[model samples]
Target: MIDEPEPRRQTPQELRGLVGSANIPTLLMVIYQVTRDERWLRPPYLPTRSKGLGDHDSGGLPEPVQEEIRAAGVRALLDLQDGRAPAIALPDPEQTRRMLEACVGEPVDRSYGEMFAREFRRRAGADDGPARPVRGGSDLRVLVIGAGVSGIIAAHRLERMGVSYLVVDKHDAPGGNWLDNRYPGAGVDTPSHLYSFSFAPRDWTQHFELRGELERYFADTFDRIGARPRTRFGTEVVRAEFDEGRQLWDVELRDSDGLRESISVNAIVSAVGILNRPFVPALPGLELFGGPSFHSSEWNDDLDVTGKRVAVIGSGASAMQIVPAIAPSVRGLTVFQRTPPWVAPFEKFQQPIDPGARYLLRTFPLYRTWYWLKLYWQFGDKVLDALRKDPDWPHPERAVNARNDGHREFFTQYIRDELAGREDLFGKVVPDYPPFGKRILLDNGWYRALCRPNVELVNEAVTSVVEGGVVSSSGAVHEADVLVWATGFTASRFVSSLEIIGRDGQSLREAWDDDDARAYLGVTVPGFPNLFLLGGPNSFPGSGSFMHFMEVQMRYVGRLLTCMFDLDIRAIDVRKDVFDEYAELVDRTSATTVWTHPGTDTFFRNSRGRLVFVSPFRNVEYWTRAQSAGLEDYEIVAAP
Candidate 1:
């Protein structure tokens, strides 16, 4: 428990002011340093000062605890100040000194980013001396596969740097997943504002943007970023291999006309995300089913559901959204649930942003910053509190601590409230697991949809796909003409579908043995010189916005490429030891998060039951690691 402050207290307005005025500038400063965006500061209230117990007048922590908190905050701030994310569970001063050596590959008092930038600028010929204007040579040629968010970002970066690069997408147009998944209620869970690229900001029309809206946002962003001119639509990357002798990647491509062509690029950025391939579980009699059947990721538009019984398999995120959105239109919807998800009540999960609020955010920068800060705090920081272990809490079977237990209770209350006056449906809707044991879902009309007369939630796995319907493990059967498989992707298998061959005939699949998808700072792998991965393994923070992770990766990769160009280096690859050590640390940190809870079985873990999908560390910790790519972490090769 925190120590009391002699019963002294401030007025309500004063307290309000304290909460409102708390360290927003500091938070803004950190965000600005990382994103280099002046607009983030427009948020009114600062959350940093309030986040720490020391700033609260009602209580004060013990001196030692306070010192630790201060140290952690300082480390996080310093990391941001240096363009890196903060480190989690920062080591004490002595341990810090030791880790510093590992980070820099040598003992240096300065931070990792400072050392990196110093080396980078010196190599780029951008250091102190007067600029000798050398004659410009051919523009850097980069080939980006998959014109999705990452591809668009890569193209934008290349355009901004005046480097020539072409974006090739297999789809008819851009917006990778947005284009691919047109299922009912397909939308982004993360706020559209924060979900978008930091370089390109947009005033999203709705809080919960539908697929079309998100696609439009992407198109607008692509146009604004000047990527549209360089995009090759309906083009696909068949094979990409590194030419060790030439130090360039030879990419085989297929255009719309079925003509094969090859392109040589100085560098290749694989922006094709983890959800590249749609997976279908092998069930007996799957081929015998004559009705319309498709994966949720590949929703079919030709099939109508207005007066048909539908059986939706898999109770994942997509399943939840699809069931609710399509329930009204379907004659009857039977949802197959393998495991029930924990639902958290969000007041505005399905509500549209008020026009006034939108006006303020779009017109007034301060309001927008304030709004973002609120989201950053609620969505990112508060969860850390519940993760702390409680020694006195007896019910470890439910949650790890009092905070966690409290969260469970609050969520349980929400479920009960949603099911008020309908006790019959309560048994069906209530989840058996603790809150966050599974990926906590926001109430987006899920309960209301389930309450409908035509919708039935089945809690059994499908045993077989029969001619007219699917049979469950319990011997029960549900008849349906249309079956939508909402079963999720093979998340643990990073870069699973990509046919990438590296040095000495080494395949990316064989290199990792189909399990270990390790990368140095989740960007580059050994023997895959000049190839950068955007959203690689162990890079995703389990509880935060993926855009935050993407931003970190983009900045880190950008810095590394900048360093290579500056140093006249032709290739940079992660050292094996560095990659292993980082992966080991990721595994260690993941052990403590709820993702590792024994009762939970999430896609975050691989078939080996190893936590591989969601990163276990704090977002700040990732920010620290990705902000600067340590030279010692990689091996550099000069132009041959």
Candidate 2:
């Protein structure tokens, strides 16, 4: 008898999931490296003495390069939202390329092109075959702009559905926020395990993941789903026009090579998230500061800060992470705070996943699914009730209303308990805003860093950046050798920097006008029929993993593709009435949540003082709403 195929022997590392190609593993390594998570394999991915993001120039640029840098910085100081400054001149492009090559090793080539082409032919709707008639005039056409998480997810879903789609990204790759924000402590606030796709659960070694790991996750996502072939790297969507006459979208793309190309598609999806653009605060004498300074999102990686005295502005999530991560290394750290933040107690924020749990998750995907589900409800949906305004509860300043008041007391006690002995810091750390009013920051050594002897948390708002340091409005000048602005991205305004035009010569900026950024089910717009949006307004989840929400939107887009196939519709635009109705529902729901609490300031609200980005409903409600599209929700156009 032929010997039965020998049972596959799994490596020890494989069994432990220490080695893998998934996103979470890399994320685990990153968190472990940065935070020294004892549970993970010791010594995470560490680069030998390199420039961190927001590093200032150390007088090493040529005259021309230096001039360009000065010009960009001056322009940014003048107008925060004008455009992204060009990357500072590197140590010669070829030399930098060589260094990168040495670091990552020789590039590995994969045949995604052939894979995508084959899958397209095999799964393309009914008209895939040579004899099949072109019922809708073209075979499986889709357009996706923005190469961030949402963009990647949309492309993956389209690929899975065998749709012929082009994904355009201004950046070199995916991972939106991850790609853009590369500050010293740049990492995910959520646990890496829960912050990933349901279809691609990873054996992450730690809870919070760092930037490199997140980027790898995006790379692995394309590798897993075979979506790379349909992507145009280093290409930006300058204009997207809706052609009502042909039921198509005309997209004008510009690449790094300076080549301009216009393509037509039956549908368009804007995957560019609101957080892609950096928002630097405007302050007097900001340009006059001769020392190093830059936004947290657009981190400069050449200026060294090993022994420099640092001044960090904006005590938000990024600020919190930046302060703690750089505290141990910097000579002195001065953190500027506009308002104290409510510190929620999360024990696992800086910890690693248990070994037993890792085994179950990696070996059995069901366990992972169950864990994600538990997180979905525990973190995502459950908070909706907690955020509801509690009319009966006491304590107004600590918490605005009742349900909000209850949550505040619960979190305040948690913080009080954590800082039991340190009353001095407790007074400074405890936030006046109700819990969930702003983005609740996880404890990634922020509290512990505050207790450090070298770190100082300043509660005063900054008024100006002098030559030596920053002067607060309270007339205190804190001297520093280097300044780091951990202020976050320009949120609430969708695709503000990019110049995009839809049908009838309508610009996206004109349509949004910095406020009223709404879309149909946070995916489609009425006038821009063929255009779909991924992480558009009202789609951002207030709790849980943003990836979970992205997956839901991806699945929804996939279903739409299925409809395009089954119904043979060339295009479908959300009805204006339907979009308006959805926007009204979103507004009504948001008004009742803690997000609208009068006492707090957050990026979730627009200039009009209206909450435009976050979802007020529970995760299940959103999932159900996005699971399938109603015919009445959209106006479909059929081919003649």
Candidate 3:
């Protein structure tokens, strides 16, 4: 027998090479969650300061010290798993409240502690018991439109509760926007770990995954949960009518061959997310263009743009991603901008996850959960204070208040540094409005792309599309062989394509005339009985990952369905007064945010100048509100 090899000793740099620099705090947090030792929560190991605040310095600890701390933490984990160290008790209600408060640097409502504990158990795999099917759910059925994230989630929860349901998607597969959008550099801006479902943790290969990876995640999730057989692909819901007498919904569907069929169900869930519909701007002579023209969402891979001149219109999130991707290959690129977006600098925006980190996420216990929690605290409400409009602030043009001004200065400096030598593009790239006035975009070498010699950034308004190219308001025409429309969706038009008739033959569109959309907690409406909306109006969070909001909404909807079946209720409509009260609160809260400021004009607002696309509450607030089904808020009718 040969002598045993010496145990490998890893240095701080070596460990970081395995994990990432941004994941150091996450590793320590995993140890803290497992051991509940306060020693793991001290400085140099865990972050003592919050992000977005001026005090968020890294302290620049010595590399050797960091190595020692990580080594000890690793040893502790091993000992705990090997039964050498005792497992600590879970945090009590009060302790959880204080912990969340400290983690977020804000006072959290006590109700969130319960939510936190439930989530903790679920992520820890301690709560994987089979769902106790509702007693009366066998007789009920649901029709979920669109097999996207929201639709998949709705189906999963419904099936777990033993409810009979069917999912219909227009695409050939389960991924919704993910399936439809195959544009270049299509991916998520949120961190990959936090962007995923809490129950289904994935070992993402990139810090911010691309479109293919995200699409695969959804498809795999669908297959794993056995939702594939229950879903009808290439099927679209054309219309749905509520039969008041029978208390059921008659839904019309169209297949790929244009054949129509109708089915009756007890309830309906509209999950055709807000971004499904592509909005191509109505420019003169658009139909007369001879070149290949399409929206960014409707990307055509067949047409090769290897060396052809390409014209890209719009400078929003999608355009930001597209410009940097296609700039290198195109013979020349012309980008038209209406308003410059504030691009925040994130070093890991384009970096892939380390193999060692992926191994830890897949192999280690509680590592992914701890990593999610760290991201939640860092990105959750850290910048919420900056979005609030300071009533007495004098400078409204530059920023809303002193704190907002500070953020503007920081972001501006980042832009300045990124474009240091290219001073000509500075004024053209920076926005004049306050931060969060529009959706914040992550930088993916956008400025660098704009500085390329083959790329041209035009700030003029596009008048129309001519025979060979686009005409600007300055009487100049830019020629191109390909034209791309990155103009975003008509988000205010909720369920516009579907003709949903509610009680007494009232159309949903007629009720919300002029696109003034409103709903009760973004799930139910007053006249729409036995109907629910997923990714509905004002349901999107102003901050944090949108997947978190969808999970909360689906859970709440599941509880409502369970309660209805258990109570023998045929129809449940939200009280008119209750809907009014909630809508008023939403309006009041939205008025105080930067989204409604004078100088801002964003897609978040509707035609009537109301903030209908995004919710005004923090992530915690929404989670607390959607934690339970408020039976008292509805008018329940007994089954006929």
lDDT of 1 by residue, 18-108 (tens): 3332232322322333343433323221222332111131112244433333333343333433445433222233333332232212232
Candidate 2 residue runs with Cα over 4 Å from true position: 1-138, 392-397, 400-406, 637-640
Give residue 336's lDDT in candidate 1 (0 to 100).
85
- What's model 3's overall lDDT? 0.79
Q: Candidate 3 regions off by >4 Å?
A: 1-22, 43-61, 83-86, 97-114, 128-130, 638-640
Q: Rank by lDDT, highest first.
A: 3, 1, 2
lDDT of model 3, residue 563: 81
Candidate 3, 557: how far from true, in Å? Answer: 0.5
Give the winner by lDDT: 2 or 3: 3
lDDT of each: 0.66, 0.65, 0.79
Writing each residue's lDDT as its tens digit, candidate 2 over 1-640 gives 1123225544444433421222232222222223333433322221122111101112222445334333332332222122222132112323222222222222212221222222222222212223222334238688887777787777666665666778878788777678778888788877676677655556677767788877888788767777777788899877777777777777788889989988888777778788766677798889878788888876687767788899988888888778878888988889988888876665555566666455445553322433443344345544565676666657755665665666667777777777657788888877777787898877667887878888888888899888889999899999998888877777888867566666567877777775678887788776666677788888899887788688667666666666666677777767878888888998888887888888888899988888888887766567667754665677785433
Q: Per-candidate RMSD vs. true structure?
A: 11.0, 17.8, 4.3
Clashing pairs in model 2, backbone N/Cα/C closer than 3 A = 53-300, 54-299, 54-300, 268-530, 268-532, 390-402, 390-403
Off by over 4 Å in 1: 1-138, 384-393, 421-425, 638-640
Better of 1 and 2 by lDDT: 1
Q: Any idea what lDDT model 1 has?
A: 0.66
1 or 3, greater by TM-score: 3
